[model samples]
Target chain A: MSGEGWVAVVGTGPAGPEWLTPETAGILEQATDLVGYGPYLDRVAAGHQRRHASDNREELARAGHALDLAAEGAKVAVVSGGDPGVFAMGAAVLEAVDRDTAGRWRDVEVTVHPGVSAMQAAAARLGAPLGADFCAISLSDNLKPLAVVERRVRLAAEAGLVMALYNPASRARPWQLGRVLEVLGEVHPPQTPVIFATAAGRGDQERLTVTTLAEADPARADMRTLVLVGIPATRVLQRPDGTLRVYTPRYYEEAE
Target chain B: MSGEGWVAVVGTGPAGPEWLTPETAGILEQATDLVGYGPYLDRVAAGHQRRHASDNREELARAGHALDLAAEGAKVAVVSGGDPGVFAMGAAVLEAVDRDTAGRWRDVEVTVHPGVSAMQAAAARLGAPLGADFCAISLSDNLKPLAVVERRVRLAAEAGLVMALYNPASRARPWQLGRVLEVLGEVHPPQTPVIFATAAGRGDQERLTVTTLAEADPARADMRTLVLVGIPATRVLQRPDGTLRVYTPRYYEEAE
Candidate 1:
């Protein structure tokens, strides 16, 4: 268990196997050990790859373990549900690398492989809500202060940015999303289109709802949901089958 | 040729066939007709599918052509390089859907299948430059005014957001990216990490450069390049192999 050590951070994309990019899949297939949250680890097609699953909040520990294993000559795959770089395991691993003063972890070969992001998949399911200059903001506030999240939300909304909010709500933080809606309501009209897309591409387990900002029920969004808030240029088309297709136009008209 | 109308917008990621997501690949394979920019359409593995390739700026016409074909019972796919929704074809198709007053184009069953966005792939290649909350802004300013792009870029920089700037430079638009760097320089330190990733994942044509805001050579980037600007929190780890890995931490440390 002692040779050139390396770690690959992989994104599975929206909690399904088909979303795996070829590069990410290649890394996962060659992984001697896979580490991630329990739920995300379950989504990997682990063909004899040892699982190092941990709880949701144990990100740092999981990252350290992955780095340590890689340093011991293990081909480790630290998996994230969406794009690993987007508020996911890639950050945690890099943080561990920076802080590991006792080990030769800095020399460990680490790479991040891109995967389909939840916001990307969610926007796709709703047609194309992220068509304009958009921002992806994680509302969890676990990594930063709540005030900072609110400040960013307000600035983004004021800048006419269509936004995709990740980690909108969890059992421990159910009110943050509602607060975000309140902030958005101050700048955007109540008629602004918002989409609550959950478990996109998850087959039979998927749920999608399109509503106006005033009508959006924040309670409907759990940890799995990605909430897309549209800019003023966003439009919703009605299908013959009575479904709604939300998309932002590519061209932006000068604001009156 | 008359039946129910349908259109699927697909993303062929990073100018490489291997980056095609399974969902997007399936749509292209099943398409009776494929429509897109001349280069992007060429990437689709269209086996006997009718191709409706158009010049890059003819997005609306290409979208209209796809809709017309779909209206005639053809399973049509409007293709784009990178993610369709990110400064590409999805928004144009949606705009066409919204503006089509004469035909029943609004009723067509249109779906967007997400692909690995150029920013995502480029960030992966640079080792997670977008590891935290970030925004993607297209610097073309052809669709919108340069003032608007500058305003957003300034706001993003002032808010300490890591930014992925799409269409940063082109033969026709060489100075805009330099102007953007100037604006970012006003708010951020000249030492901020910047990545110039071009033709990412595109076989031997690929190139990657990591530099700082002060040293960033805007001339090195063209339309095919993706520019990622790091926030103050972004860290660069220099490997023994003489390469640098830039990543923004998951948790933001409180500024003194």
Candidate 2:
């Protein structure tokens, strides 16, 4: 093959297919091969496309494989949960392409398709915790040093930006989130709102936990959870029916 | 009309209707009243829904009106461009609810549906400039002080976070983006990549400008543009076809 094929790195969004953009859905339908982690691949219904499943830890290898397939004239779709550009397969594939010393995939075209990210879906579920200035940091130290994560978390907290933490905790790195919480508590008030959203937009599996920094438990978060820590201005409102909503106001109160 | 109605704040994404999520599309279809800024409301087609268009500066009024309609048994969709939860109408509506001192709208239920944000769309277009830890700061100072914006911009830059600047410039606030650029230039090297993407995901109107900190001009951006400034680790690669892609590596090299 003359590398006539192309690769589309697509995000299926979070939860269900209903959150998928029409553009992404159409691209999924036209792909010759679908490549992604097993669970994310499960979101897309099996069709005429060939499925390529891999473990999440093997992002580089999977990206290379997708590139190889595309170079061989196969239209490959690298599926990612949430927006592919945000700590997902989009960068991994781009990294692979950058490291292709021989330029074997030089002629293969690559494109990125955006989707509703996990933080976005989670924020939507909880009203608008990320309505103003915000920063997203993945607490998992699998790729970067824990120190770098800690430094970034502290700076984001100090800046008073609403913080959305991805991969908050997992079996492999349980203590990282606790340490992050410690860093956040040092800068924000004890009453600052903390929200833990699991499987948001995923139907019945969706669960939202709202608490304050003084009472937030890191143990409540896992790999599937997205944790949002609010700035001092973040507010929690209670509806008439007892449901709760959290959002940061757009206008910041510069000290009276 | 016993205040039994509900409000759904829906994001139509950046440009076209194709970027609309199925869930948001369904909400738009079911809403009896569609309320938003004139341009954003134009993205949704005419239907049985009553349209209420307002000026861009009237976000709070538009939100209050939507709430009022919903309280009157109208299934209202408050439309926003890109993810409503991100520097959009989501916070405005929630602010309106928060200020309902008399609790007149207590019975009204509100929900948010996330969509691809402008920064995410722009990142996708540029091949993942936000691949790692990132922060979004709105450069418009209409609601906040310039000193605050500058401080946050400085903190985000010093922390080495990829920065996405929303509302980079407008006719009334043209100098704010220039000030932000000056702050960024102080912290980052001259070679830092600065991208100004306007109308991303919108067909013919979409335009992308890529330059370095030394060459970037604030005049290149407008309110419609989303600007992305890369971290020191950010790299730009040129493909054989003469196109450019920028991405930040997931792993940071700790000081040697």
Candidate 3:
């Protein structure tokens, strides 16, 4: 099950088939099997002739199965949104490959394709708000402890860095991001701009209101939502249509 | 020449035709005229049925031409690589439309189709080095002033932030990135990780040796290079093959 096998960890992009890059799309189209989280697997186009193993909690096992299929001379893709290595299945797949096949897996050509991360998608929606110094943290304590998350948040805020919060909250960990906000409040001003971007690039995609840090409601966020907390220098400019765009001035030369 | 017309600023992804998302591809396929920097236009599929205006120095003029074509009832797509808003023509087009067309272009709907930015491409090559806090700055002062660029660099480095420096250096501005390094050296340790990722995703793409801040050679960098400077906490891990990867410790949970 571990001979002549290779795995392509592909990013399905932030949302929808339209956002999928040609390289990623080509890999998916050529794969004989697709393995990923249940929701992410559902996002791949159906034109690809492939079998799929979609399980939310069985990532490790699914990775093993995909490697097995690849060993059988089948092209395999382990799909993840954005870049797989960025808080996704890339490290897991590599670890699984290493453990299952030992150093033998090194001979197999493994390629990790990049995708548009939710942070980038959120920044685009917010008018280059991430153009300044920023940090990204995943608030989910499922893998790590809340204390670690808090420390990073506190450090970033105290250092006047913008932050992008992933996995801010879900059904089971609904208060994780809220706790994070509480910790951040100690270091940042209450008027700091906070952007809630949900389901970025998906059908129900919505860029929620940018409010002051004290006003952000974590309950309104979900697994698909990305929270961006700006530093003191971040500003929200309101448009005539009542929508607001957030940006951190990077101070460019005055236009001649 | 701008009544009831629309413009779509599309991203052509990192490579050839396959990298173009379906939405962007569809827009380009339907466009009567495509406008962008010279190299980007050449990358579009040869069979593309559109007149193209490829000029680097004439971005604003090309954008105006695209708007004129759109006003004449021909759908127009002003294309850029990666996301148009990042450091591309999308913002320029919008700004020009705002200034030149005013109310006349109000009815003109404009949509920005996102693409894979070079930073994401660089991150993928380096194995998620950008997973933590980061900022992006363009060192080219052609359209922007050097003072503005210096301010952002100083702020980002002082915050111990990872930074993605685009347009690092070129034939005429060979010493820009060196000056940036000088500023960064004052704030960050001399041993910080610096990655020079050039021609990412192309056949000739080269992922340079990631070295410490004190050892990086800016002379080897160019406009096509995307330079990543890691923060204090960022560490370069050695793979079995001795290839390096960068990761910022989020410190998840404290080991209880």
Candidate 4:
């Protein structure tokens, strides 16, 4: 097996060590080379693997380097925080492989290793807000236009689907999340449940807040946070002990 | 912690034991009661834990029962085959807890443990169909109306979003998958990439087939299969060794 080339795109899942899956850990252990954003690469156990850590914007370049190494018969692993397929490196790696015109790069074996996505962590933390048909749209207009982003938000709301908004806000684009909230307010009621969970399941830094859309402050969210907006059927309950929980019902109303 | 009422909703991820996460495994090992569909409960290691396995159609009843066990101060674990939050039991449990009205159920603490969702497993197996903006809709009209399913399919295609379709077809509903495929053909080219993966990541009985929209047959998919349809940006590449791969580019196109 060593004679051929292979690359594993692995998701590190939640930030805490315990959240790491055994399958992903085992795949990283066998990696001869690890490539990813610096912090994600650091998550791989320090060993014989040569690390090619880079900045966040270098995903395409990093994927190329991983593919190049794999083509040379090295066992390469491209590490991405959370699930690689969801707004992560899996897409970049596959894009690189798909666009590779040379036969050498095409023959390199590639596989994506599934891990728990950040949305899953947020949903787990704040009860299940995504219990029905849903859509995930990145509010970041870095690649797509903001107009397109705005349209998707409206269309998703019109469809009454629970939505997970990725890249809701960054320091540079603090107003991005507010715009979506405004569109949501037009369609959903003020009491519609919205959850902001930052660095969820990451031990101490994690912060979870369940609130109504009207009460949700975009300033409370940053890059680390994932915002979940529930449909009209979503409900928030305050327990007798003052703790709050939110959930979307599995059944949609129909003619009985 | 032992005296307090608590329940852990665990997602068993893919079909095999090796795909199981350590955290979920540890929680299941400590459970005093296991509740889920019969097949899901069977995945739990048999021991002292009392099993309350039921049929698939009884999700709400099962969730209520799990909460009942937790309210009785038992270490209960409700296992879902995939990520509990994604069209599964996580919402059911939370909804049951929130609407109990008797107030006895609200105090039964619940936590959802994130695991790899079935869509993630399918995306991993077939490169990255979900690398960009995506939506997941259950094609099973058992709960929601079939018209809602058909409308969402058209709208999702109109939005140019990749789609992950769950419960595409069942033995009783053999014609359902065909309907969605027909809608997909209307919006997409006949050569649009489509993937059908059944019992993914399972050691055996796992099947993966990649075909275009025109070539795909609904007969190939069943209840266990997940269908992935790519957007316009998606591509299919044939390697020198003749293996086919499909992926969506991470970079969203800008108006030139």
Best by TM-score: 2
Residue B247 in candidate 2, Cα distance off native in Å:
1.0
What does candidate 3's lDDT look like per residue over B1-109, in tens digits? Answer: 2344567887777666655677787777766667777688887745555757576666667777787777677777788887775667666665555456355544455
Clashing pairs in 2: none
What lDDT tens digits, residue by residue, belong to model 1 across residues A122-141? 98887888888889988764
Tell me, what's the RMSD of every candidate?
A: 2.2, 1.9, 4.9, 2.2
User: Tens digit of lDDT per residue, candidate 1, span B122-174?
Assistant: 99887888888899987764677777888888887766678999888745657
* lDDT, residue A33, model 4: 87
lDDT of 2 by residue, A48-100 (tens): 89999998888899999999999899999999999999989999999999999
In DockQ terms, which candidate is top? 2
For every model shown, what is its TM-score relative to the native structure?
Answer: 0.95, 0.97, 0.79, 0.95
Model 1 lDDT at residue A155: 85
Please give the ranking of all candidate structures by DockQ, highest first, separated by commas.
2, 4, 1, 3
C-alpha DockQ for predicted model 3: 0.29
Indicate the TM-score of model 1.
0.95
**What is the Å distance of residue B154 in model 3 from its true position?**
6.4
User: lDDT by residue for model 3 over A39-138, one digit each (tens)?
Assistant: 7888884755575757666656776777777766777888988767566766556556546545544445556778777777776665656654456666
- Tens digits of per-residue lDDT for model 2 on B1-256? 1235889999989988778999998888788899988898889947688999888887888889999998789989999999999999999999999999988788899998999899999999989899988999886657788888888899988777999999987556678888888999999988999999988878798999889988999998977899999988888989888888988887775531
Q: What range of 10 consecutive residues in model 4 chain A has the weakest lDDT sum?
A: A247-256
Cα displacement (angstroms), candidate 4, residue B204, comes to: 3.0
The collision pairs in model 3 are: A22-B18, A22-B19, A135-B133, A145-B253, A253-B145
